[model samples]
Target: MKLREALALAIGGDLAHLAEVARQLSSLGVRVEPGGDVVWGPTRLLGKGNNGVVVFCRSRHGDIYACKIRRGDAQRPHLLDEARYLQIANGVGVGPRLYAYTRDVLVMEYVEGTPVADWWRAAGAEERARFVADLLRQARALDLAGISHGELSRPGKHVLVARGGRAVILDFESARPGAQNVTQAANLLRALGLTPPLEALRRYAERRDDLAFNELLSSLLGQLKR
Candidate 1:
């Protein structure tokens, strides 16, 4: 389906309202990418959630982005808030790069990778170790930035393990202040069958300094080696 049609379906309104929406999108310099047909229902989409749906888009410059659009029934204009949190995460190197956003739309980097679940199972020991370490750094970054991902303990499909073993944490829609990112990530590590480095993690949580972080990394890496 066409981008306008798909967006109209996701966010139904009067004809005039829809036309205005199209104008806003056009002014933002984005449109559906050719040959990109990822879909869930009638709409060509990258992903969908309760608040919004994501579609693949191309800038006039032809760079691909994941455009998040607010669903019709969603609480209005949450993408702006999501974009802000994502920008904070981007500053700390924890989430996808946010490019631009309006009340109903968000444009951000498109991550091509496997969910951590599938990726972990296929990754070799060293790869798994590297993935864990990357996630730890990202988690620590969020912790230090004081933004909790809000669902990291039940990470679900939130962490994307891309090529070269970088683990990109996704969906800052639920991110909030007063983070416990490292603690939640340790819980995730436990769920993934690694022993949590409790004492080291606690020390890192208390200090959040380089020495504490290095000790925690060493502890986690030793578990992977065993």
Candidate 2:
């Protein structure tokens, strides 16, 4: 299915929105095979949510991107807010690089890797400990930026581990700003069975106190190193 056809299928009964979506995709020079089971524009379907279907796409220059298209009205009605949050996440290097986002579509750099749970399951003892530590750093970054990833507590589908062991957090549609950033730290402890409140981690990031942060991280890593 080309962009036009895909838009038609996604927007179903709404032909006007369909045309607009097609136009938006064309403006971005995106070509997709939505009819395919697992592929689109030299990329593949990474995941799909009530919000939209996330497909992998490639540019003429051979750059890979993740494209998310709204599902009709979308279960989450705040596409713009999600896009804004994505920009915030990008600012802190916490999520994928966002290319563009419209009322019904979003395009960003494709993060390649396994999910965090899968990665943790396959990692060696030392590697698992290191990965968790890196995850804490990312969470701290988000807290420092005043952005809270509301989904970290159940990050099974929102976190990805790149080939080089880089942890890439995803989906900022539910993020919020406020004090007491403990979701990331608490989530990691529950998911990884390691205990350490994230409050200290957030303070370490806000104060830019690297020595203390490293010391804390090292101490935690020691307990987890196995």
Model 2 Cα lDDT, one tens digit per residue, 17-87? 66776676667766554432344344345676666777656666666688877766666663788888789
Question: Taking the tens digit of each residue's C-alpha lDDT, what string does model 1 give over 1-226?
Answer: 6756756876665676567556656878998553334555566667777777777888998888988767666765457767888899999987889888877778889998887877778788899898888898898888888888877765446788887989989888888896688888888878888887678878877888889888887787898887
Error of 1 at 35 (Å): 7.2
Off by over 4 Å in 1: 1-3, 12-20, 34-39, 200-212
Best by TM-score: 1
Reference-based lDDT, each prediction: 0.78, 0.68
Estimate the Cα RMSD of every predicted model relative to the unseen true structure: 2.5, 4.3
Clashes of each: 0, 0
- Tell me how far candidate 2 lies from the true structure as C-alpha RMSD in angstroms: 4.3
Error of 1 at 182 (Å): 1.0
